[model samples]
Target: MLNNKRRFSLMTTNSHSSSQKVGTINGTKVNEMHAVEAPLSGAADEAFVTSLRGRFVEGRFVYRQIFAIRSYEIGPDKTATMETLMNFLQETALNHVTSSGIGGDGFGATREMSLRKLIWVVTRIQVQVQRYSRWGDEIEIDTWVDAAGKNGMRRDWIIRDHYTKEIITRATSTWVIMNRETRRLSKIPGEVKKELVPFYLNRIAVASEEKDCEKLDKLTDDETSERIRSGLAPRWNDMDANQHVNNVKYIGWILETVPIEVLEDFNMTSMTLEFRRECRQSNLLESITIPTTRVIGESNNSINRKPHLQYTHMLRLQDDRIDVVRARTEWHFKQKLQ
Candidate 1:
């Protein structure tokens, strides 16, 4: 039992969502795709679930899940939206936690936090996209946990085209535990520590360096080569379970200003976002994108260097111009799809 002083929150609510029938991705059954909030009968059940999603690769538990790009998941160009890729990554993480027995069930370490009124929040995340998966394309996301600070944990992913096995995107994220009642950051509880520590693997991360997530340039009118600003209003369905506009929805808004030529010939290679505030219903937001690079610099011999373009993005209140999120994206020209 955890002492009240050590326990961060006093939440004791126990609730479970009705399980929905598993749906298919590409003519394949994905039934059991929903979250498991109750513990499995025994270790044998756990092993079976783990094998279905992914397996242990040496020391790390690697989970593989497939996502088929639906029409709604694509942009006007008919390629997968950045938000869709992000959703797949987020779902994979949830699945990983549930299957690991660290989360799921109203009984484990993760629920223990909820039992104590604590919740996990993402502090930062960075993604590097090589190519956007097209509609009808099945993509495989391989996700694993990496060692983070004692109070937090890091997760990384490699997304690939399911059939071709070509890498499409790489992402990494950092998460911290927060008290729901006091709304303050908290250390990992002993229960969670014991459950998560053994799964931490010393492996090369997708977003390798700590500094990659640190600095996101603020958008300003002064610096620019090309720029676009679009008005954005969140729809009713854009809200998530938490009632605020979902984080992935912000990615779609940010990409609205990316040049059509870039979207057609090149691909978004890297993106970093610093979420400063949350937007609720009735917030009128402006999605602004400003290209920061002037030219694709040529090498010493005048040979063409890879086309590199950087754009700074901001989601701001249209009325007051208050910032909700600031992000930066890097793009690379692609010769052809692999």
Candidate 2:
């Protein structure tokens, strides 16, 4: 068994680590029940360290971290909500970039863009989950970067069970730098590239050969389609420290357009979202959800299995008809609690 101290060391290197542990019983250490078991030989120890520290691949330094699913993050099914996992991945990405010396208030400090005051923004993300982790589950997330367009870069992550190492989810996201004042996309600066080139990875996080990551089916103003249009304006609490609508709030608004029957009966299996523009407190947007046909087959037959549904959702400005976000969601029947 790995000692509690050594395990902690593997998960974090900084003395001022922000890692949190959950699911502790009365008078027991947080890691007591999470201790890993492996051989004590030198080779085994080295392998364990590599897995925990995450080695570089194709020049990308993969960072690994563990998260204990807290009670508040779970839904009625006692499993972590999709939004919660997204938050974890988002935070991990920020921490990774910060440690690389190119994050936070110093986003573009190395380049002239700093003079213009630029910030990195997530343009798109696709997340697929094989399983939703229950409360108290300890999961590990490994994240890295891939070469992207000259103006943007791609980041990817693989989340897994810390004990069994079963992959729980895979995600890929694209980000671009923008001038805070102008609110316009900016070119990747040479100095920024200098800091990131050493860690660029050639591999992708999820395998989607046929799907185009850049283009998502947007909600059209088709009267023939069953569309749910609702007013969506952000509240003060929905805004983040960045002075923009929190990304998680977008997910909630998108779901608001989903049919109540679907929301009550189904569990979201996967989602691919493209954030075209940012939303502010003053912006009045319309949420639109267009449900695609239910592809019923053996997989969705009620006699053989549960039903599945898919929807194409979007958030657009009510006044100018500009798209703020476009996304696709897949859901399946949720299992009843025993």
Candidate 3:
């Protein structure tokens, strides 16, 4: 096993080597570049390669990376979809763990966690989007972790435009350990805590917003103006390395019941998801949405005003009606983006 100091040194050495290759475009420095073209012969080489993708900052307590928006990641509006942004956040978090030398064979799991057959599971997440990135845009994302209450870990991210340094999105999430074999929640092992405690930072990515202050109300079938979409199942490709449907897939399903008009005319400015249970490939699911406030009509004057459309969403198993996830979303007119 590599000691913390040695691992950190390896990262810095690789980062300095990569920086020497950076070039300028039209007098502006181009910082984004591919990792070194070399064979991964051992763990040390693998760590060096991973450092090229992302690196630790702020005294090695925070991770920062830059990603360029691709064509496939954009929607009809020409801006990167919410799912793409979420994926970026997830990727950076995992890379942070790997670079820290605490990661094990399991995804983002510490060595002690892998020995105990434990994996991390996110319970809740909140994302606020002030702006969306367009195709060919380079966005920088920074992520850091801190303690959540006693047993839980809190991770937060800030996404910004690489050139202007303007904030685009902010997100925060809570995660806990679960036994991979038993599929039950587990407490943090002492050894795992010791490995992670030194890297924790007291930071807030999304401030001025309520943190679990108000509970999202459950939507029922009897509710008026409720929309339901049934007969949803996960594809084989939807499964992550953990042999279960990826959490990002749940966000797509939750929006299936939303009105097309809402999706087209408005941009989702904020979303909060509470994952209650896991979904598998064989399970059928149903999506339900209830409008919490009336959808605003489009008008010439609406462009200048900020009006929010709110909805509550639920995803449950088709047969047992067991809630898989519950969420609340807030949207504003697309004209606001302009």
Over the stretch 1-338, how does candidate 1's per-residue lDDT look in tens digits?
12211212222223244533234545775444532234344666655444446555544577677677889988766788677888888888877777676673422236677677776667677887767787888777888876577687888888889778988678887777766567577988887676777777766446334236457766665643356564688999998654568778888788777777888766676777777766877898988888767456552311123437877788888888788888877776654542
Model 1 lDDT at residue 205: 48
User: Pairing residues by index, what is the TM-score of model 2?
Assistant: 0.76
Evaluation by TM-score, superior candidate among 1 and 2? 2
Model 3 segments beyond 4 Å from truth?
Answer: 1-52, 208-212, 294-307, 336-338
Q: Point out where model 1 deviates above 4 Å.
A: 1-60, 76-78, 104-109, 181-183, 207-214, 220-231, 295-307, 334-338
- List model 3 lDDT by residue over 1-338, tens digit each: 22311323212223656423324435675455322333335777666445438888899999988888999999999999989998999999998998899899998898899999999999999988887899988888999999998899999999989779988888999999999999999999889999989999999987744443468767665872468989998999999988788988988998899899989998888788999988889999999998777556653432223346888899999998888999988788786554
lDDT of 2 by residue, 1-338 (tens): 44431533222222233444333435565443432232245766666665544443333488776787999999877899889999989777766775565554643233344554877788888887777899988888888886687778899998999899988788888888887888888888777777778778777877766233545766667831565565678899988766789887888888877888887787777788888888999998888888765755457322213237878888888889788999888777776771
TM-score of each: 0.71, 0.76, 0.81
**Order of the predicted models by TM-score, top scorer first:** 3, 2, 1
State in Å the error of residue 310, model 1.
Answer: 0.6
Best by TM-score: 3
lDDT order, best first, reads: 3, 2, 1
